[model samples]
Target: MIYKVFYQEAKDSTPRREQTRALYLDIDAQTELEGRIIARQLVEEHTAYNIEFIELLSENHLEYEKTHADFSITEF
Candidate 1:
């Protein structure tokens, strides 16, 4: 299954603050619990920030795509 982990930088009472960021991960797991574990591990190993939320975007999907289009309308 694929999951979108929405995490933000941990708030700190410091002079310099970090901006909020989100990460999208394609997790391969059987259950939600497994997915969360994988996501947490990935973040812990790769990043130095804490996660705020973990959301499931889709299941059995490997890739994500986006498209853009433009249209014109006229009224009299």
Candidate 2:
């Protein structure tokens, strides 16, 4: 299955730190559930760094567009 990971920069106002990246990943996996798990694990591993995960509920064209308008509007 194919998976898309959307990440956003995280800022720690209290600590006065910021990360300079807005991350997005496209991955192919054997299963959707496994893909999500893998994405979760990646976010967990990067917790120490200034990284934040923005979960994608569905990869469906319509749904994905509703969630993110930055991507092309046409069906995927």
Candidate 3:
């Protein structure tokens, strides 16, 4: 299953308060719990702040379509 995790980070000066910047990650896992765990681990390793929210966007099909769009070139 593929999950889209949405997370918000805090500012350097204020760790408690959230900053304007946000991160969106697409993760593959068997379950929602696993996805959340992966998201937490990624945030811990990569970012200084904790994740504010973690959600499952879609199961499998839609995620791929959204991430990889179909494109074509037409000669004029």
Candidate 4:
């Protein structure tokens, strides 16, 4: 499944809504808890951002993407 991992610059202060950043990962996990743990490790290996939250791709995620046209996934 795909996970949207919210994060922000580790060296910067906590950001406001507009300043938040995100990265997408395809995690092969079953539950939210499991996905979260995998998401953290993936982020750590690829970036220096402090994780804010991890969102699994479900019904709500699809709606969010529709509403925010700029939402994207990076293929590595």
Computed on alpha carbons, the lDDT of every model, listed in order, comes to: 0.57, 0.47, 0.55, 0.77
Residue-by-residue lDDT tens digits, candidate 4, 1-65: 77888887773676667778877777778888898898888788777788888888787776777
Candidate scoring better on lDDT of 2 and 3: 3
Best by TM-score: 4
Candidate 2 pairs with clashing backbones: none
Sort by TM-score, best first: what order? 4, 1, 3, 2
- Judged by whole-model lDDT over C-alpha atoms, candidate 3 comes out at 0.55
Clashes of each: 0, 0, 0, 0
Q: Worst lDDT window (10 residues) for model 3?
A: 67-76
Q: Give the deviation of candidate 3 from the true structure as CA RMSD.
A: 9.1
Which digits, one per residue and each the tens of the lDDT, describe model 2 over residues 1-76?
3334444344443333253433344445677676677765665576543434434445575466546655431111
Task: Name the lDDT value of residue 58 in candidate 4.
Answer: 89
Candidate 1 residue 57 Cα shift, in angstroms, is 1.0
Cα distance off (Å), candidate 3, residue 15: 7.3
What RMSD does each model have against the real structure?
12.1, 7.1, 9.1, 2.3
